[model samples]
Target: MSWYVYILKCSDNTYYTGVTKDLKRRVDEHNGDDKKAAKYTKSRRPVRLFWSEPHESRSSACQREAAIKRMKRTEKVALASRV
Candidate 1:
């Protein structure tokens, strides 16, 4: 199965990075008032997908998520724009 590394643009204009095997479900969780949503995203509801990259494995998706998390906002925005 394909894994995914994704960036979400939150209502507060901040970005969130995460990895998931099911992108659609994960995005829905972030936008919905569900227990599955990340705490960081829960308060910043109504997030929209800013960018996503597919990976062959969960490990790779996690690695990319980490890398993106470490990037500056400008850098992340640039990366998102390219997607």
Candidate 2:
């Protein structure tokens, strides 16, 4: 199964990084009232897709997510702009 490392720009203008197998479903959950959604995103509704990268494995996707999470705001913005 394909995995994805995604960056979401929350309604609050903050970024949330995560790894998911179904990007569409995950994004929908974030925007919807699903309890499965991340707690951090639950309050910051209406998040927008800022950036994403495909990965062959969940491990890689998770690793990338961690790396992106460690990135400074400016670096993350640069990454979003690049794609």
Candidate 3:
């Protein structure tokens, strides 16, 4: 199994970054009724997957996610558009 760092483009135009093992299911949870869904995206609802990168381990995926989360919105947009 592989770990992945993912970026979501929220309905209100904000970006959310996180790590996940299963991209499809995780994306569904973000838009699902489950309370465990990402808090930042729950209200923003209807988040679309903007980017993703696979990593060999959970640690690396998490590190990348954190780095992406720290980026400014313009930087994030640039990153997403580049790939």
Candidate 4:
């Protein structure tokens, strides 16, 4: 399965990083009115996808997500712009 590292711009202007096996479905899930969605995102209500990178392994995707999460907001925006 292809893993994806994704970044979402929350309604509050905060960024969130996560990995998923199916990027579209995951994004839909985040937008859905489901209690299972992460509380952070659930309240954000709507999230705009700012970036995505496909990876051969979930571990790699997760590592990338962590790295992106560590970046300052401006740097993260630049990284996302490259996608």
lDDT tens string, model 3, 1-83? 99999999899988889999999999999999667698889899899899999999999988898898889989988987888
lDDT of 3: 0.90
Per-residue lDDT of model 1, residues 1-83, tens digit only:
99999999999999999999888999999998578899999999899988999999998888898988999999998997885
Q: Put down candidate 4 lDDT per residue, 1-83, tens digits, no spaces.
A: 89999988899999888999987788888889586566789989698888898999988988998888889999988987775
lDDT of each: 0.92, 0.92, 0.90, 0.86
**Weakest lDDT window of 10 consecutive positions for candidate 3:** 33-42
Off by over 4 Å in 1: none
Reference-based TM-score of each model: 0.95, 0.95, 0.94, 0.91
- Please report how far candidate 4 places residue 50 from its true position, in Å: 1.0
Clashes of each: 0, 0, 0, 0
Clashing pairs in 4: none
Stronger candidate by TM-score (2 vs 4): 2
The sequence of per-residue lDDT tens digits that candidate 2 reaches over residues 1-83 is 89999999999999999999998999999999668889999999999888899999989888899999999999999988886
